[model samples]
Target chain A: MNRLACLVVVIGMALPAFAQDARKSGFDYMGPDTQAMQKDDLANPGMLSVLEGETLWNTPTGKAQKSCAACHGDATQSMKGVAARYPAMDDKTQSAIDLAGRIIQCRVERQEAPAPQREGRELLSLSAFVGRQSRDMPISPPQDAKLAATRAQGAALYSARMGQLNFSCAQCHDDNAGGHLGAAPIPQAHPNGYPLYRLEWQSLGSLQRRFRNCMSGMRAEPFAAGSTEAIALEAFLMERAAGMKLETPAVRP
Target chain B: MWRLLGLLAVLVSFDASAQTLVPYRIENGAITQSLTGVKGDAAKGRAIVVERQKGLCLLCHSGPFPEERFQGDLAPSLAGTGSRMSEGEIRLRMVDSTKVNEKTIMPPYYRSEGLERVAANYKAKTLLNAQEIEDVIAFLVSLKDDTQK
Candidate 1:
């Protein structure tokens, strides 16, 4: 009788520990590294957008008669680590610039072309291709004094409350890290896989699109595409994912 | 006896309502049908690729047989995946891609629940039904050129 009682106590203690491990190992965030290795129907389809992006990368436009190739030749070599270093602070602008903003800057300042619309397919695809070149590299945004202030601004945006839902990014991604919003568990909004091909979006999309979605979820007015606030937030997210490998054009739930 | 009959009638009505639900046709399927109808015809699944729509299987995967314009360079092709997976396994993935990977961005065609926050009109319906999923499975199975097993 005493042995049976002792065994029951041991089983009870072991059960909770096992559950904790299971929770830790199970699919909660579905990080990019894991997604890249996992087999799925969407994986191949995501490449179609990449091919489109390649075409856009080389096609010239505007008065400069310059394409992306004009400035950055053979993307595979030139763009190798570019994606992993953005939402970087510009020494000239003294503000944060994400991959999209950088592309627009190139067009406006170098090529002298009109900026593409926020959700344009050409922009999304080009960004997707550039991001893909940096796949598997660790995120490494510059951290000098000029960027420190921007990083601080980004941190504030991450935790600040906005909209009718009154929920900040931290509420779903951090404070309630392992909690479920419904059937889907919330992931720690890592930017390692920007310019991802989300099944929900049914096409390639940028981190900025996801950010806008979160703001809309909060019922707050989303920041415009190239806004300083959005760029700062991107910088902050990239910093958070500093050590993680980049998996651009990744598939997401 | 009367109370028992009334409860039976209510249950029947609820079941009937469940069958007639219509959600978004992100893929090809009879939206008014149950989740069972969302399964694609494996034979016809290949023909459904419309660039932006359902036939996008090649976007991330490369099939064994290569079509020049539609093939993607980033993902592994799906030419002989039927040889790798069982019919039941393919069915489950086609019906709901999430069962395989929670972080997958793939839509759950067989999803019948957990959509409370979606637009109200789509609340009752599933993304796709079982029939469509099965059809897609059939098409995938046919892709196995070498039936080694």
Candidate 2:
């Protein structure tokens, strides 16, 4: 498993060979400095939020007077590999819900508490905490035997050209993955990292934040944070990243 | 009769300058030069080509830009395009390169036909306007090979 194979053939007219089965995460493409940062949990800036999330996880403030651990027990044991199976089909909603969406849902329905903020500070803390539970685990987002119609819709949305640029995700990420987008290497976008720290962002953030940034980069009006379109795209990304190791709280350049 | 003629004159002027949706014809992976009726501004074209917000050409295509620190290494360079391709071929490519290579990653900057999975908001518009297309063409046409530059 030579990861250097991914770096071959980038200079000439020849495109890099696609190893679709490799399941490479975006973190694999980061600079050594970034890799070092993410590898060190103590040094990673994202860990700030993870620490906050740990405290939040232990504190019981919901109307039902229960913490995430009350029913689930210690997250280290109970939440292990949980993030790997997200954007899952919510039995009640009957639609896909990512890790963040599922957590918000739990707050409302299970805990009988007020709806948590969408990508708010608290939510990000909790998401990063929960996501960190599955670090190094292989991603395997709900592989229901039945193909989801919503997944098909998600495929359409992924390929759709939006914004003033008339560019689709397929135009760049799919067709030209591993290609350079102005000195910036465009890695095959696997949503394995979330609550990841980005140099441009200068902080740890959720996948939804990155999605919004990309949408605006195309000069297109972005979908709302928790809208069906955003969720669908999330599901599609999670599916695309299946089998890749989760790098939650990963660092990026 | 004088007033009627004057009103008609105003209406005709408005229609002539209006930016209507234009149609393009593709034949054998090329669009012949017969259909285009546009004048280009190379200076403006230079700006458009480098603009990440709109043209976004730099996202994939590397070109001669000493001032800009970053240039892509994805698609072929646009530096010596004039020496390599005819204006007509360049025009066709810019409008819709997929006509020549269906699987090409380059977006059709000036066409809206036969595209599947386009966002609803941008359904009615082409990526670049006719004048912008002409400007880009003029800029490319002015690119005289590296020896000449």
**TM agreement with the true structure for every prediction:** 0.55, 0.81
Residue-wise lDDT of candidate 1 within A1-253, one digit each (tens)?
Answer: 6999999999999998887533221123666654653335354456777888899889998789889998899999999999999877666776677788888888888888998776688788888889879987988887666778777888998887554333568756775566544334567788877777777777777788888887765446777787888888888888777767877777777
Query: All models, DockQ values?
Result: 0.02, 0.29
Model 2 ranges with Cα > 4 A deviation: A1-21, B1-19, B22-39, B112-126, B146-149
- Recovered share of real interface contacts in candidate 1: 0.00
lDDT of 2 by residue, B1-149 (tens): 42443334321111223335455554434444533475788999999999987788887877788777677877888888888877877877898776557666777787655555345666656788878988988998888675532
Taking chain B only, the TM-score of every model is: 0.56, 0.77
Please give the lDDT score at residue B113 for candidate 2.
50
Prediction 1 global C-alpha lDDT? 0.65
**What is the two-chain DockQ of model 1?**
0.02
Residue A252 in candidate 1, Cα distance off native in Å: 0.9
Kindly report the docking quality category of candidate 2: acceptable
| TM-score leader | 2
